[model samples]
Target chain A: MTTLVSEAIRAPYDFLAWLVGLWSDALYAVGDALGIGMLEYVFMHHAFLVGTLIAVMAPLVGTFLVHRQMALIGDALAHTAFAGVAVGLFVNSILGTGISPYLTAVVVAMLAALAIELISEVTDAYNDVSMAIVLSTGFALGAVLISVNTGGLAVGINQYLFGNLATVSRENAVLLVVLFLLVSVVVTVTYKQLLYVTFDETAARVAGIDVTWYNRLMTTLTALVVVGAMQIMGVILVAAMLVVPVAAAAQVARGFRESLLASVVLAQIAVLVGITLSYRYEATAGGTIVLVAVAVYIGMVLAGKLQSRRGVSEEAGTGSVAREIDAGTGESTDD
Target chain B: MSLEGIPSVGVGGVETSRESAEAGEGRRGEGTADADRVVDAVDLTFGYAAAPVVESVSFGVDRGEYVGIVGPNGSGKSTLLRLVLGLHEPDSGHARLLGHPSLAFAERERVGYVAQDVTENTKRMPITVAEVVLMGRFPHAGFGRVTETDREHAREALRTVGIERLADRKITALSGGQRQRAYIARALAGEAELLVLDEPTVGVDAESVDAFFDLLADLNDEGMTILLVEHDIGAVLERASRVICLNREVYFDGSPAAFAGSDALERAYGTNLGLGAKTETDSRGDGS
Candidate 1:
């Protein structure tokens, strides 16, 4: 029965791996044609694939999180994911078993996500005090666990901490594809409810959307995104992908749907450009991506300021007209 | 006073109007006989701490009735609204919305809520006026896709509220009064029969407040049951057909004219120290 259930899940991952192989070949061909040196290597192909998926899902979940003032929750979850990776490494060393640390990280991060939700629910507020405590606790646990198993494990930890472009394994890329599918499908199904809850908790409740259930779902999805992005983004800089793009999008987009689309587009730019720049400069991929994202954010802020300044006079005139129309209709309705 | 296994108290203070007297009896045994009672609270009590914020507040709002609940700040007016909407569970007794217990009330689309300037808190959220209004149809659409008919209803609601021209504009860019209208349009798009507003004119300008009340009165005339909770006594007295003066309990529940004639406002507001002091003791006795 267990094998059957595992097979059901494994079949999709196998197909995704096959798709990734095809993508690598296509990239190789394109690299030969366009004379792009970086795309010639298989690891670089995996890196780009992983980076692209991270760009899509990170900001997709991040848009809701950023607007809701829960951006810190992403940073908190990433720290906990580091603890998860530490636990996986410790267990593997002790038991001499071949288990993926990313798999364990997913489990541990999801647990931390629920713990955060539970604490908030019990406290009757999402205070930063509890979040800060949880974050430090996760990091402390990871540090302590890693210190206890100090040798080859310490060397490999740098890849998880700062993120290495050359270390993008095929299996890790496949895991990200699965996470991407899960996050996107859930968000698509519950977009309206999530938007309502994020925008106005009271009205959403009165409208009969179970706000608590949706909040839990949101945090859990954030955990998945954090861990998946951890491969290319690393534990330290993973959260920037979740926040910077969304912040930039909010500056320019007029509507929620527009902001969501814009954030995803902006993140794609950050990821693709940052990856290329990282390869050329021999810089850390996560650091490069975050730097690019922040640069984009600065550009958007300036653009938003200029746009508002230009529209100020036009807006003032229309504002009065709108109010006058409201008053007129009110009087006409009063009989 | 015990927290556990407290028996539901019998209904009292149902004398808001002749209609409510009948509705109260309908609640006791006849059930569906008072289908017009859009909101009914029988000895409802709740508090965050030990001292109950709202205590034994019993009243019934029949269809098409314009009811206004006026009280001082921290007098549990908003908390009472939460109870009626089933946002918080009552410590005891029952609060019903459209005949169902508010907590378990399933037909949510029938009731509309216009909160006190939700935009003040969510000012930075990037949502257009059209998008916000479309949320009213969310309860109806559930997991299904929002159809063209839903969009049509949302558009009609925006037009009704006189913000059809500003449909594409961002909600945060609008003034306080305009934001409230957008919220009302959202409620209307859901085709709500009972429109509930909690201090809808908090930061609105004086002229817009008058216009907002006029719009509300017009909706009331069109057979919509309106329940408004406001701290402004004069506004409630001038606009609402029925007035409920509350401070921890139902100090007075009757017509606006009767409420104005009586010292209900003074007692409820605690302006008349002697009467207010006496009433506080009396309510505490009743609560315990």
Candidate 2:
């Protein structure tokens, strides 16, 4: 059985290697032809599965981040993650020790998230501004560290800058699958609590729902989902996943629950399609997925506008969509 | 859980309200001022700042009293409820539920508070009507899997507010009046002795507003003492038994009849009291 399994693993590699070699050559030709593909095209040595998974989960997670009004925070945390990965790699290389750079990245990402929260609380300024400042400062710190330790691939950190699915690894794929499951389960179990707090924080508080802890928990989860699994996708557009799907879902969904479900479904579909297209055309998966999600959002807006010819949406758009549904249905929303 | 078996914990509790309501009912037989101490506040001077929203606002609400808190928009009537619920610390003076200090945390079990705006956080996730109501049981939703008794209480709370069908509906989807009912149901689930709602009828249709007032009246009849902070002075003059006015200080605390029978309230409100309106106010002010 051991020999059979060993043979099974060895046999697939012959064809896999051939396909990869040909695929890499075609990618080089395409990049050369396009005149826009960056220098990182040489390492067509990535896991397609990992890139696809990242494409799917990033936006799915991004939806919650956007809803929670944490997009800029996401961007900042991704930058901080670079520092974490670099530091971890630096330590491992210097000591001739073995440690996972990505796992270390998760710890640093969490600290960055925590720091952002603390800073936001102290500053009381608009959240996105703080996130931007944190992101720039974090990346600067990472750059300094990279400069201090110029042994390996700092210049080749285009995956962190301009994403390349061709460089995603097996570890990245495993991490992503785990993070996705964690996010999915947490969301499902606390779905109602999240909904209540989101819709009416004050009422939830009055009703004795602890809004503070849940808010922190959600951010913590998003940080984990982002940094733990980001190797599959890259930092160039991590916030896209957190924002685009929900933005699109909100455009179409009638209510909050519908929005959540729609966002997840839309995100998953967008990622899967983005992956297949990226695979076939050698396009950037993150960019393609975000673009598709935007396309879906536009479609939702058009569909909604087309459905309401009399501009009932315009009227209710001022106050609430609930009233519009009630108006159209003739169901005396007599509250 | 059986209502009887549920040991009252928070100030928003059935036992507390029932006792207070019964005590209020007992006062009707006596018909004397000595028995009118449903909610006793002593030397109360509280607000957001040193200026004080409620200063020397000394007063007592008799059991089963329907008290209306009215004044101009910034008069601090809503602040008074927050003080009562112990959500805010009073700068000075003292407020109490029954006989306990206003800051008493456990005393919250007897006080059900509804705010002017019950909006979603817009950042958190959605929760169902049933689950929102069950939040009243936060003190109880522990290792025990929200027992059958807790579910029954939640259901009863919904039925009491006349929104039983909306148990599973999202709070974000309900109409304003229905949403208010859900809020009321949450309070009832807590079994509050004093149900306090700030602007319970604001922005609701007149019919829905009337329905809400009517429900509060029914709760009042069933021995629940209600303290309402409202902008709809017209309906309030008809509903509340005692009226308290605040203008950064206690202006008036008395029966609705005093407002209807005299020119004092008309002058205070800065509106001419029409003859027919006075007659209508008198009829409703003298609670059955």
Candidate 3:
């Protein structure tokens, strides 16, 4: 499946042209289903399944990460997985084996999380220092391992660095579907505990939230999300998979749940639009997706800021009119 | 963690050996230990990264007693308060609250704590004072949707604090004193047996200080035990029944007058309590 994606776009807009053909098939199916239009049901079903997979996965967990301020940490750990992938590839090549990259990436990211937690506690080292150490060492070791191998493991490593979504495989997409549901369920069940930990960690600790355990669990879960998104986002730009969707949602979300829902919606929209347009324009799908997500983020931020400014002026004008009434009544407070 | 054998900092600025201090203090007054001691700290010790900042300490506050803790900067007064509040784990000995090993959330609700600043949350402000105060009910009601009973209690607490009218205002919109009061209301909404406040008077203007203290005094009179960490003892001492002076360790624990005029303060500090900063000849407790 990955091999097909690896070869999907032979030229610019190649995939898009194929999608158009697929769309015609979809129109035919829809027309058959409705007996009215030219669209096909099979195409819509396939698009919906794939679109749903892309939209729901990254952004769901991404919102949680962004709300908790672990977005950059997501990026750091993804790179940290590089060393693991590199090491796995070298061992596989040497042993005449082909280890699953997802398995290797996840294992490395978990190890990185363990190392991060350990460093934060046992030493005076800052979180960024620990992240930096994992990131640089991971990439360096991965490079060293790949340099010794004559195969295209180096090119594979570049997939993580630059994201080659064009080459995503069927089995991997199915794996993504399973993972998307798994993460969503786990997060929902532990929603309150997560928010409590995010809001006031110390208070949560004093409240007996078992903060240390939650910290480790959350980091590991975040790693899992990273590994899942890596197929579409690529390793290099995977942090966006963990951050942008959530950040954009946060700008307008009324609460924690609202933010989560908004992020999922935005991610799906961006993924479909980016993938469709990239195929149309003959551009990199992953790059186009990130660009769209970023534009959405900027728009949300600008709109939110304007709304807040308007609210402030309205408040100021109302404040003075109520001032004399307050004084006369001896309420003496705008509060 | 040397809470057992290390000498505590001298009281009233008096640097003396344990033998001399014990022998010298018996004649001062009768040291009455509380029967219903809620906070029992025995040989308590704490440090940041293992260089002992708070030395061996021992003290007890009875149930429903409003004790004010006063000290100079770097005196570890706030550190001691944190230990009692269960924010920082003590290095050694025992710091118990309500017979528990330390403060727990459900248990801590019995112990309301308001830090100095009480900074409003940075996230979108929850609408209404009723909503803000109901946040204090978090220990009792974990997360997700809030209940009607919670809002009712918050309203009752607001009415108690005489700020029921401000019940609808955003917490960020409240003044410094009003905000502090609202925080108190939040703490009070907990219906806590003991309210631990750290420097509740810092940066509050003189009038606000009087009002804050007056409000605190009124609450204390109504049977809520307040363990406060205050910087300026002048106004607080006027209302405080017992004063606990911490300078890396317990300086003295006794009556307010003995604390103000005694050689314990003169020895631990450099001089007697400097008077004339206020307009009142406040009452003081007998030295023991």
| TM-score for all models, in order of appearance | 0.92, 0.70, 0.77
Write one digit per residue (lDDT tens) for candidate 2, span A1-335.
96797598675555555555565566567657876344224443234444444545555556556666666667778888887777777777788877777777788887777777667777787767777877887788778877888887576566766566665654454455567667777776665566546555655554455677777666677688667546545775776677777777766555565666777788777776776577668787677767777888788778766755544555355335443322332122222
Instruction: State the fraction of real interface contacts model 2 keeps.
Output: 0.11
Q: All candidates' lDDT scores?
A: 0.86, 0.64, 0.66
Candidate 3 lDDT by residue in tens digits, B1-288: 112233545452344234224422542235434445678777788998667777887766777677888767777888887787677788887687766667452465677666665443334422345555665666677645557887888887776666677776655555566667777787777677888888876655565666677777778877888888887766556778777767777776765665555444444444534233212323323212
Query: Between prediction 2 and prediction 3, which has the larger TM-score?
Result: 3
The 10-residue segment of model 2 chain B with minimum total lDDT is B1-10
Q: For model 2, how big is the iRMS in angstroms?
A: 7.3
- Quote the lDDT for A39 in model 3: 30
Tell me how many residue pairs clash in candidate 2: 43
RMSD of 3: 7.8
- Give model 1's TM-score versus the native structure: 0.92
For candidate 3, chain B by itself scores a TM value of 0.81
Candidate 2 lDDT over residue span B177-288, tens digit each = 7777788888888788888788877767775677677778778878898888887666888777776655555544555655555543443444554354455556666653
Q: What is the lDDT of residue B8 in candidate 2?
A: 31
- Model 3, residue A178: distance off in Å is 3.4
Candidates' DockQ values? 0.59, 0.14, 0.19
Best by DockQ: 1
